[model samples]
Every structure is written in C-alpha cells, then in structure tokens.
Target: MSLAEAPFVGNASARRVHGFAAGSTALLVGDPADGSHLAEAVAELGLVPQSVSGGSAGDVLARLAREAAALATSGAAVPLTVFAADLRVSAVALLDLVDRPSARTSVAIAGPHEIAKDPSAFTLIRVERTQRLVHSVGSARHVVSAPNALAVGALLVAPEDVPAAAQLWAAAADDPWVDPALDPFDLALVALVRGGVSVSSVPLGPYDVRRGAGVTVGAAGSPWQQRLYGASRGDDGFFSTFAVRPLSRRLTAFGLAHGWSPNVVTVTSLGLGVLAALLTATESRAAWVAAAVLLLSALVVDCVDGEIARFSRRFSALGAWLDAVGDRVKEYALLAAVAWVSVRRGEPAWLLATTAMALTTMRHLEDGAYMDRTATSRSHLVPDRLDLGPARDLGPADAPTSLPGAVSRRASAVSWAKRVAHMPIAERYLVLALGLLTGSTQVVLWAITLTVAGALVWSQGGRTVKALLGSDGYERDARRVDGRWSDLDHETDLGPLARGAGRIAPLPFTASVVGVGMVAVCAWFIDTGRLPRVAVVLAVLAALVVGAGCRPSIEHRLGWQVPAALWGAESLLVLGVAATLPGGGQWCAYAYLAAVAWHRYDVLYRLRDTGSPSASWVTAVTLGVDGRWVLLAFLVATGASMQSALAWAAVLLTLVYGAESAAHWRAWLGREGALRSEVARREAEV
Candidate 1:
C-alpha cells in the first residue's frame, strides 16, 4: 500500500496541531511487527507514513532504493525524514526538528543512554565544532567513545541526493558483515559523509519525552513552539529586535492562528508603506508624525510575513523576491516624497535624494555581486575566514583578521552589536522615519548618505582586501564574478551593425570604464548647459560610441568592481540630465530611475535564482546599457526640447520594462504553482 493509505493510529487532532505544510513523507524502518507505533507517530506529525520491514541487508537495500525512486519520481523535493520504529521519542520533537526542509542532510541525535537502548540499531557519528562535519560512522559503542558523538536516530535524504542514497545502499547490500537491522542507518550515514555532504545534528535531549513508557511532549506551553518563535526572530536590526519584534511576534502568532499566508501580510505591509510615503509629502507636523507611525507599523507587518514563513516552513521564491523588492520600493518612495516636500518649501533637495538613492543602489549591487561570486566559487570544507577565530590563519603575512572570540558567543551582547554594524533594513527604516518626523529634509538625507557610505566603505573595503590576501583561490572567484556581471546579452539590443563592429573592436574592461566616465562628464556639461549644443552633441556621441558596440570583456582580477563603477557613472548621467529640467521633470527622472532600478534588481534576483537574467527582448526594449548611452546622446542633442524628450523617455522605459517584467514573473509564478500542485496531487494519490 502507498504511505498515504497506511493505517494511522495517533489521535486525529494531533494531525491538525502539527503546522507543517502538506505532502511531507516519513518512513518507518524496523521489524514489521513493531512499525505501527512509529507510523502512528509520523501520522500525528502530519506526514505520510510508510513502513519498511527489516530483513536481510540486501532486501532492505532493495526496498529503500525502490522507495527513494518513487519519491523522486513523484516530485518530492522535500527530503524524506526516516525514523526508526524502535526509537522511543516524542512525535512533536521529531516533527519540530525535521519539519524545516534544508538541502543539507540532518540526523536526529540522541544521548548515549538513548543510544544504549538500541545500540545495534543506532549509527554513531563524530561531529566537531558547529560546522557538523561527520568524519566517521560505525557501531554505536565504538563511535560514541569519541568526543561530540552524535547517535543517529533518524536519517534525512535531500531530494538532490535521493538517487545517490539509493545507489549507495544497493552497493553496500553485498557487504559480508552488514547487519540489515543494525547497519542500514550506518550505511546511509556513510553515503552522506562520502558524498561530502554537510550533516546537521538535531539534538533530541531537550525535546525528548520518554517518561517511563508513554511518549509526552515538552512542558506546558509547548517549548518547541517557543523555540520556533525564537528561531524565526532571526538576526534583524538592533532596533527591530528591541522595538519591533515583541509586538510583531505576537501579531505573527495571531496571523498564524487565523491562517494568514506570508504573501497576504506582505501586501498589507506594502500598502502601509506606500500610504506612509504619501502622508510624508503633506509637509505638516501632524502628517509627519502620522507618516512616522505608519512607517513603523509597516515595518512591524513586514516582520510578520518573514516570521510566518519561517514559523510554518512555507517559504516561496516569489515571496522572498517580493519582500526584498518591497523594502526597496518603500524606502525609495519615502526618500522621493521627502525630496518633493523639500522642493515645495523652495529648497534643492533632489540632489541629496538622488545621492542617497544612487549610493544605496550601488551598495546593493556590490553586495549582491560579491555574495553571488563567493557562493558560486566556494567548494571547500573549511570555515569561512569571517567565521574563524584569531588563531586561524587564512594565509601568511596578509591574512584578514577574524571576529574576536567574544563575538562567537551566541548570546553575547557583543554579537548583537556586531550585527548592528551591518545596518540592516530595520536600522535604515528607523533612520528615515525619524528624519522625516524631525522636519529637516537635508539633515536626514545627509545622515542616511553618511551612514550608508560609511557602512559600505567599512564592509566592502575590508572584503576587497581580504579577497586579495586570502589563500583561497581569488582568480577562480574573480572569473565567476566576471561571468555574473558580464554575461549580459547585448547583441540583439545593439543592432546588426553594432553587433558586427563589436567583433572587430570590442571594448576591453578598462576602456569601457573610461568611456562610461567620459560620457558621465559630458552628460553633466550638456545638462547644465555649460557647453554649446553642437559641442555637447559631438562629445556625447563620441563617448557613447566608445561602448556602443559590445559589452566589456573583463579579465582583470578586480573586474567585478567594473559593474559598480559603470552603475555610478549611469547615476551621474541620469541625475545630471534630470537636473536640467524644471518642476515635475525631476519626479519623471526619479520614475525613470525607479523603473531601471526595478529591472536591475529583477536581473540580480533572476540571475541568482535561475542562473540567467531576463529575456533578450526585455533588454532590447529597455535599451541595453550601450543603447541607453546612445539614447542619452540624442536627448542632449535636442537641447531646446530636453524636458519633453526626457519625459517621453521615462514614460516609455517605465511602461516597457515594468509591464514586460511583471508579465515574465507572473508566468514564472504560475508555472511554479502548477508544479507544486502536481507534486501535492501525486503525494495525495500515493
């Protein structure tokens, strides 16, 4: 029988209380005679329970292989949480430990006494430090003698490793000394270790509830639920933790009880943020106070969406993208509104607002690029340099300094202080709200600029130095970065002539940077009307033509920085061009920048998730970077009608990029939902 049709004996209400999403699978492995209780426990934890009878080692291996294949074919991307029927553990504990799906393999670990109860059934593995590297797996007594011994009571097979697990088991079936009942867990542990998979250990001591005979959950008020809440409160800004979470967590719990999805909470938060921005533009004491309150309220709701996702293990890629983009939209909208109010009061605040927006965007681009590069290039088993202690050396004579020992303590205030240095969304939002409330637009704008500038220099500057001096393979990392940033498909956008010319004289990285720099300078001169229109048109055209053909071929070790440099240049060009216009023209420039920013961030998210950027047509319509520069030249040439030209450009860019991007992502989401539904349907059938 399929696991879904298996006999379940646990209290039916228990199934409703377990908050995991539908379609999870759990396997009960033990003698056929005693598997009923295990199946009952799995059912109680809201998973489809299947039983695998103990037999000869070869037979067990065959059965496991078949089950793994079935799960794989059924589109079960979530890992299979396998439990030993002999294990006397609380179902609540097991569910709490393994409900959150992860790519890494995790095993439920028990104390020596618990292992002693089923010594032959357990596989003891040695784990060192928090990294949880399993070096050896064997008989319980032999392996448990080592320090940090984790006795495996359960096994988790990540979907990607499902086939490997099946093959490893089939291969081990012929081992002469393999005990089917005792060594299946050992063989699985060995497979994970040999495959270089990091093993996470979920210790069961705190959650264990074997009081004499009957299983029981933790003390009154469900400690597991409390732990879930705590885990969901992840490391946010210090202000968020101290000021926002206490209320947000309660609201999250209320939402969870009422069956609210993360996406719903996200929409609510977005509305509040937008409303707050609109109110901020009213330019009055009452409106400012109301805006500040609403902004903070919006942040609280924002925290709820993420917390709900974590608490219920209902994460979605679309939800993540929306949350990230939502924050950017809210912050930018607030800045623009403040700038508008300042302008209404007869002040030139667009410059400061533009600086803040451009600086923030540059920081985000650099951060994302650096993170993507490092993650893709990482292939080692050692701790990252930032995680190591001072005694750990990265390389001779030029090693970067590690976090101090005090910072390693999980509960230390120093650790919290260290996180605060990152200046996360919570901190940034608080700064913006406070500045808006105080009625000093320039002061708040400068505060944000200086703070972000300082944080960027502190973070990226150190990382650049470390990347250069570390013993890790910097060349490989640089190549990955280059591929990520320079993988843009500009041929279609550049037209046939430009594409053909690119073959003969493609711009090198250094020349492209210089060319973009020249364009920015000339654009500024043109916008301010400091140069004759004919001279401006000629110089801009010359600068644009330098990169009008192809993308930069970056081969330098520091080519990753080239994108940020180009982005900075683009900001200068846009701001300078916008400055030439009068009243509403500035908002049009901001709108154009916003559209471009959305596309840029969309590219980053898509590249990170799918390993590809938006489609070629999208780039063509938006006018790829080279096309944009050429277009700017034309706009400069229309010196008398600059305002009308700029307005049309902004409107066209927004409509084309925004509409196409929304349509693209909507189609993607629809496909994803359909796949998920198919998987769930298959699970139900099984």
Candidate 2:
C-alpha cells in the first residue's frame, strides 16, 4: 500500500487530531508544541511523526504542498495529519491538494490564541470542506474544548464585559510574530493555505530571491556566465575605444594634406643636402646663404614627414629605414663640400682628418646601435611599446585595433633635442642671425650645416646604439635576428666603383692626377732661386715622410719609426720654407697643400671603394691626428702673421673644407672598394 494509506492516531483530549480514511485525509492545525504533544499521545494509534526543516520561504511552501497532496490521494481507510508551527509557507503550495476529486482534505484551526492573532488564518480553515476535526468543538458564540470548565466560567460573565476575540487579535497584531506588515502576496498565500483553497500546480515562476538585492539570478541554460568570464576574448574593442583624441585627429588631417610620406621626406632631405654641398663648393657667400636656407628647409620637411606618418597612422618600416639612410647621406654631402673648399684654400692636413674621424664615429654609433634591426639595438629614447591607454578610453569607435599601450615618455633627452632643433621658424631664423654676426656668411653656412649634422648624428646615433645593445644586456632578447654585426655573411656591393679604374672616365681622372704633377713641378720651379737647394730637398722629403706616416696600421706595425721619419721631414720643410723668398714661400706652401689634399682624397676614395683596412686606418689617422695639428698650425701662423685677418680667413675656410672633403672622400672610398671587389671576384670567377 502507498504510504498515504497509513493509519493515524492521537490523544482524544489533544488540541488537534489526524486520521486517514478511504480516498481522504484530515489535518488538525494548531500551535507547534501542542501538535507535537498530540502526536506523541497517538503512539498507540500506530502513526509516526516526521518533521522537516523549512529553512527558506520557498522550502517551507514546497514541503507543505507535498505533505498535503500525499494525504489527499491516499487510498487507505486511515487518517493522516500535518502540523505546522507557522504560516511562513504561502497559501498556494500548502492548499494545492484540496482540488483533487479522488480525495478529501480537511483543515481545522486549534488553539484560541492562534485564532485570535490571525483571524484570517481561522477563516481559511473554516472555508475548507473535508471532514472538520475540531478538538475544541467550539460554537460561534462561545468556544469550548475537552475541558469545559473554562468555557463555563466565561459563560457566567456579563454579556457587556465579555472579551471579544477581535480585540485579542488586534492586540496580538502588535507582536512581531503576528506581523501585520508582512508582504501582501505572502499574506494572501497564508490565507489560501488556511482557507484550504486547492491551488493549481503551476510551475514556480522563476525563483528570484536575489531580485531585491539587485543581483541577477541567471537561468540554468543562460550564457551570462560565459560573457563574464571567458577566454580568447580580444582587446580590439578596448584599444579602438582609446584611440580618439583631438591632437591625433588634427595631426592626421595635416598629414594627409601635406603629402608628407616619411620616406619621401627623407629622400628629399638627402637631395637638398647634395644641393647644399654643391653650392658650398662655389665659394660664394650668396651660395653659402642659399645652401643654409635649403638645409634648414629640408630639415623642417623631414621633421614634418615623420610627424605626419605617426599621427596619420601611416608609419612603415621601409619609410623609417630610408629616413635613417638619408640622414647619413645628407651629412656626408654637406661635409664633402666643406672639404672641397679646404682643397681650394690650401689648408693643412690634420683638420680634415679630425672631421672624418668625428663623422665616422657618429655614424657608426648610430647605425650599429640604434637602427641595428634588433629590439636590443634600438635606442632607449623610443619605447618598444606604444601607450594606448588614453586613446583606448577616448578613441574613435572604428579606430584600428591591436595597438600596444606602452608609448615612450616624451621627456627623453633625444626627444628634447629634436624638439629644440625643430622649434618654430622664428627661433631658427634668430639662430641664423646670430651665426651671421659671429662669422662670415660662409662661416655661418658651415656652422649651420655642422650644427644640424651634429644634432642628427647624436639623435640617431644614440638611438641606434641602444637598440643594438639592450639596457639589460640580454643578447638572446635582441630584436633583430640578422643585424649588421651578426655572424652571417652579408656583403654589400658598392655598384660602379667595383668596376675599377678601367671604367672610370679618362679625362677627369687623368686631369686630377695631372694637377698633382703640375703642382709638384711648380714647387721645384719656386725652390731653385729662393731658399737653398738643400731646403728644397728637405721640403719634398717632409711631404713624403708625413703623408706616408699618417697611415695608422702601418705606423702601428712600425712603431714610432714612421712618425720620427715624418717629424724629421716636416722640420726640414719648415726651415726650408722660412728661409725662402716671399714668392717662393707662397709656391712652397701651395705645393705642400696640394700634396696633402691629393693624398687625403686618394686614401679616402680608395678605402671607401675597396673596403680596405688601410682606408679606415688612414681615415682614423687623418681625422684624429693630422686634422688637429693642422688647425693648430693655422692658429699659430695667423697669430704671428702681419696679414692676420687674411690668414684667419684662410684658416677658417681651410678647416671647413678639409673636414667636409675627408668625410666624403672616405665614403667614396668605402663604396668604391666594395664595388671593385665585386667586379674583380666576378670577373676572375668568370
């Protein structure tokens, strides 16, 4: 038999009772303690009491409903009872079984105190129609129970003095347990349960206990969980949101209008540099002024191009590479013009040598360290990562994604220097004015070129070095796998120079050599009638000794032996020139100047063209040693001469030309060397 058919038993004098009959059940509801006592009294009746905790509102309702339904459907001819201590459960879940046609369910309210506290509770029980099993057996006028002594006592009281149950209920409503302020829905549910209304078993409308707390109770099959905590989510949306700014917008617009491609700007700057050099070679003040303007304009354009590319989001690797290469070329051209001027002025050799060394060092430092194609090689001035936080928060909706957020701070020294160089035109023009006041227009031009060239060199050089060698010294973490210093063989061809002397134009080349020969012959012509023949011999010997001694690798191998020989030779030339007549003296000076210029040009060109160690050696010697000595000599000579002003002018011009020429000649030599090597190897193999 089903458990619902089980028998029920309880004390006859108890405030409540329960039993089961065929297809029906009865429930006696009352105070919880009294209900338990009644159940114990029913031990002889063969019924067991089972209690379940009603921890939450939902739990309580569900429990009440299940117990009520089982009792209503039982087929056994027995009675079962359910007792609840409180009306916490809603009326619906408790009374759902009353509608069943196959069973009868009854509810009876016990305990006078309980009935008075909640009059509606009593009304709900009275409305239900299964067998009423009221232990009190009270009439509407005067309620009575198994012990009638109390009722008889109440019946003797004066009618007007009789305490109404409503008054007791009103007083009890003040009690916390009989909360009158309970939610209306909860109150209604309690009333239905008490009234024994058969509730239809509609599924619980989604349980939402956390609704008042503003917490969403997600459905079992919902995707909210995935959205809140999921992997493989991209940050594209975040970055795009960050990229919107007024400055960025303005820069982008300007970039588009200016047609300022980074690479184009770089190449243009290089062309301007070449033009500047060519103009400077004319030795005219107007030409110098023009060259200065062109150089300045080129620099301005160069600065704008990068700014445009960065702001407009059009930056590219090739453009950056070209910009770097172009800067080197520009410097070379400008300096080469200065060197050509030195050749015309007959300056001493040491000045050119110093300039060459300085340029080479600066360029190498920049190229090797800053732009070495490795992250480690990149300069510390620029950050490896871009800072996109501000942009992300305020960027346009459709901005490009995948932007990094670790931009270099703008306060780096290199950045500051660049800003200074690219300041407003007014400031730069002011600098130009100052240069003009301090020196000749030509001097100002050289100064301007040198200043710009120096600034560029420092900026790029520092950056390149940092890039090649990481701040932390981690070789494996280098950015480029195949940089300039990498072990892999990466030979660069120097184009036309590699074809050798055969391919060179006969007239111009021959003219240059012939010019040197003529100058030498002129030296002999001046020497015969002026100073002694011995002095002439000594001067020629000095040129040979000093020129050959300047080669570093050879000197290093030969120790100080070459230097001593050159010193002896120079002593003789100085004594010989001092003793010569004025006419011969000039010619002697001119001769020595020619020899120095020719030797310098030849050494630089050969080294650059052939990639010979000797070329580098010569360059180092001339720039570091000979160049400084020549400057000193010019200073001394000017200080002692009656034509000091002329001498000074001559010296300044010589310094400018010597420095520039040495640099260009070296570059040419390097290029030529590579070209020659390529042609020789190719031809020999063929």
Q: Name the top lDDT candidate.
A: 1
Q: What is the C-alpha RMSD of each candidate to the true structure, in Å?
A: 7.8, 37.5
Model 1 ranges off by over 4 Å: 1-39, 45-80, 84-153, 158-163, 170-187, 195-220, 227-233, 379-415, 470-502, 527-556, 581-585, 609-612, 679-686
Model 2: per-residue lDDT, tens digit, 376-464? 22222211111111212122356333212333566444544454553222233334434433424345445544654565455554543
lDDT of 2: 0.33
Q: Clashes in candidate 1: how many?
A: 0
Local error of candidate 1 at 404, Å? 13
Candidate 1 overall lDDT versus native: 0.61
Error of 2 at 662 (Å): 26
TM-score of candidate 2 versus the correct structure, residues matched by position: 0.27
lDDT of 1 at 592: 65
